[model samples]
Each structure stands twice: as structure tokens, then as C-alpha cells.
Target: MKGLIVRIAAAVVLGAAIVTGSPGVGMAADATALIRAAFDNWRANSSESTVTMTIHRPGWERHLTMKGWTQGHDKALARFTAPAKDAGNATLKLGKTTLIFNPKLNQVIKLPASMLAQSWMGSDFSYNDLSKAEDILTEYSHKIIGTGHAGGHTVYSIEALPKPGAPVVWGKQQVKVRDDGVLLQETFFDQDMRVVRQMTTDKVGRIGGRDYPVVVTMRPAAKKGQWTRLDTTAARFNVPIPAYVFTRSNLQNPRN
Candidate 1:
């Protein structure tokens, strides 16, 4: 919720220790590391992915296919690749700035910071998800609130409270991470502590020779049948990506 693309990544952050530790024992008590591990796994140093997004309402559904790439925490890009009508539509985030390219209009629009909380392409994920996640992610104080076991691994329940005056909207965020640093779920709460929405890991599988949450769903707390699901069809993590990937020109005209 903290400026990240309402990503299933609540769906979590990055760190190398995520896949290294033993289950339930000799685990690092460092909550920051745990969160960083999960986040890192989700984005990694650099990654390229093909994704399928399903948006569901009470009586209708829509699907979109996209290609995505990330360059560390400051840069990311996603462009629709299917359904001819929506093809070439894209968003790019560099530092604190966000811009979207619309092939139909053939224009790139720079989004104001106030619009960061708005949805991205009318989906549950916000523009913030693709924007400056690291800046806002670093605004909270994380703690290991509880612990349990799952799939032969330790599951740490972490709670993140926004620091006073932090530029974040959630009152708190509840995170569940596995010993190996996989994020199982994240719940967002309003300032009054009311549940706002959540991102849950629907399935976990191997990607690029590492365990990953291949399927995840985001559903608002009060919406009955409205949700958005993202399926990471193919991905390669911590790989080298061309510099042009995060540029506005690339968003408008693909070169990678």
C-alpha cells in the first residue's frame, strides 16, 4: 500500500537470505531482512516476465496479457502485449515519476504524485505499484509479530506500522513470510484499522530455478466478487536488462 503498485507482491520485497535459511530454527530475527527478502524475490535485481491478468467482477471478466521488466527498485515498466486494441499501452516508473503511454492517443502522459494511489488500467493494482515502491516501502517500521510453520518452513507473521508523518495511506500492513522468504499474504488496513483490501498468494511454483508465487489475487475487503488475479506465466530473475527498458521512449516504442 505504501506507493507500490498494489502488487500481489504484498506479494513482498528483496533479499538474498530468503532461500537460504533453515525452517523454524536459526532463522534471522531481522524483520527488515525478511521483508526485503520477499520483496527482492518478487522484483529481484532485474527481471523480465510475461504475465496474464484477469479482472473479475460480479458478472463479467476481462483478461489482459502483458510483458514486464524491472531494473532494481527505481525503475519498472509494463506494456500490454495482447488483444490488439489494448496493445502498446504501457506504464513506466523512474524514480518518483510515473508516465503512461497510450498507443491510441500516441502520447505519453506524466502522472502527478496525487494520482499514484489511483488504479492502473482500471485494475485493483494502483499506479503506485509500478512507481516508487522503495521510497514508500522504507517508510514503515516492521516487526515479527508471530510465527508458525508452513510447507516445512517457518512462517513469520510480520506487522508493519507506518511511522508518524510517513507519506503512506495504510494504518498498518500485515505480512506473512516463509522462512525462505516467500511472501504468503499482505493485508492493508485503513487509519482506523479497518481492513481495506489484501493481496494473497494463490499458488507457489518454481520460476527461474527459484520458488515463486506464480499466481496471486488482489481483492478489496468489501467487494464481494471483484478482484484482479495476476499469473506470472514466464520469468527470468536477476538477469541483465538493456538500459532502454525503463525509458519513456521504450514505453512508447518498444526496442527491448
Candidate 2:
């Protein structure tokens, strides 16, 4: 009887452990699914957008208008269209490589790894930030840390940590995603766990039958009263884009 009671107790403990463990696993899977869905919503098969970027400094502000094209997350091209001085300047990203075309010099300069952290077009966003969409889902492990209400929507707070041996610069990233697949905010941290910068959606509305952030802002934590704002004026997603548009030649002499 003593032996039989001991065996029954062991079975009950095992059953409890299984019941508790299953929910944790399920939650993790659900979190990953949500994250992937959010990323997919923003970066469709192909997208074209016209945007205005405003760089605000303590002393002055500058605005630039640009047209951007993306073929999935691996390829993207952007060309400045306004502010005559900045017109004809273009940037292209293909996989891990990025190039910039200066219309004045009529030359294409490849961006080295050392220059990835430099500001792009004098904006708060870095070249690495521009190319992050291509590798974020693959290079980091994500976990849903908590949930809360923000901007009258249910938000999922997620933490992303770099995977072992991943060539990522951020030590961790905290993201706030809405239930409807809108990314509300993302905060980036350095290796020492210091806040580096943050990107937030200042406005969200319907665009092309999909909900998206129409106005987004990026600000560096170390800077005071300085921020870069991107306002999307027009956007079309899942449209076919020509292959040549992503080439280096197109970066210099854009067809459209």
C-alpha cells in the first residue's frame, strides 16, 4: 500500500507539470505568429510609397519628399524628389548590401559595414535601420512579455533578443503591436542595455484598404528636441514592381 500511494503521488505531479507547461508553449507560439503577421502586413510582396520626411533640430528644420519602392524586404529603392538640392539622391538596398547614388558626382558609393550606423540623408534613421526589416524576424528570438491597453487598442508587448551568433547590432528590442496587426512602437537598446533610440507610430489610419501608421517618428534617446518624422502621403501594396528598378543603374537614373 505504501508503494502504491507513492506511485499515485508521482503520477499526479507529472500530470500537473504537463498541464502547466502546455499553456506556456502555446502562448509562445501565438506570440511568434502575431509578430510574423504584423511584419507581413507592413511589408507586402511589393509596395510603393510617397512620403515626406521632416528632420527637426533645435535650431532649424528641413523637409524632404521622396518616393520609395520595395520588393519584399530584401530589395528597396528610394529617391529624393523635392528640395532641388537633394533631388536625384537615391539609395538602394539589395539583401545585405546598400548603395547610394549622388547625382551631383554621378557616382554610386557602396556603404561599408562601418558606415551602417551613420545617419541616412541627415535623418535620425541609420542605414542599418533602413535595412532592418530584411533580417529582423530571422535574427532575433521574440517573446511576448505582457499585454496592455494603448491608444484604445489591445497591445501585445514583445521583447526581441538577438539569437546566438546573429550579426545584429541591438542587444534587445521592445515592440508594441496592436491586435489588428499595427506596430505601435519599437525601442532599440545597445549591447550594454542602454536605450539607443525609439520609433513610434504617431498616427494610424486606413491606407489602401489596410490599417497602417500614416505618420511615424524616430528619435534618438541621447538627443533632445530632435526627431525625424515620416508622413506617408500615398501607398500601394502587393503591386508588381519591375526588377530593374532595384538595380544600381536605376538608382542613378530612375525610370519613374
Local distance difference test, each candidate:
0.70, 0.65
- Give the per-residue lDDT of model 2 (tens digit) for 24-45: 3324435565555555445556
Worst 10 residues of 2 by lDDT: 8-17
- Which regions in candidate 2 have their CA more than 4 angstroms from the true location? 1-29
Candidate 1, residues 156-199, lDDT tens digits: the string is 88889988889887898888888786778878799999999887
In candidate 1 the C-alpha lDDT for residue 88 amounts to: 91
Model 2 scores a TM of: 0.86
Who wins the lDDT comparison?
Answer: 1
The C-alpha RMSD of each candidate to the native structure, in angstroms, is: 3.5, 14.7
How far does residue 20 in candidate 2 sit from its true spot (Å)?
34
Indicate the residue-level lDDT of 19 in model 1.
43
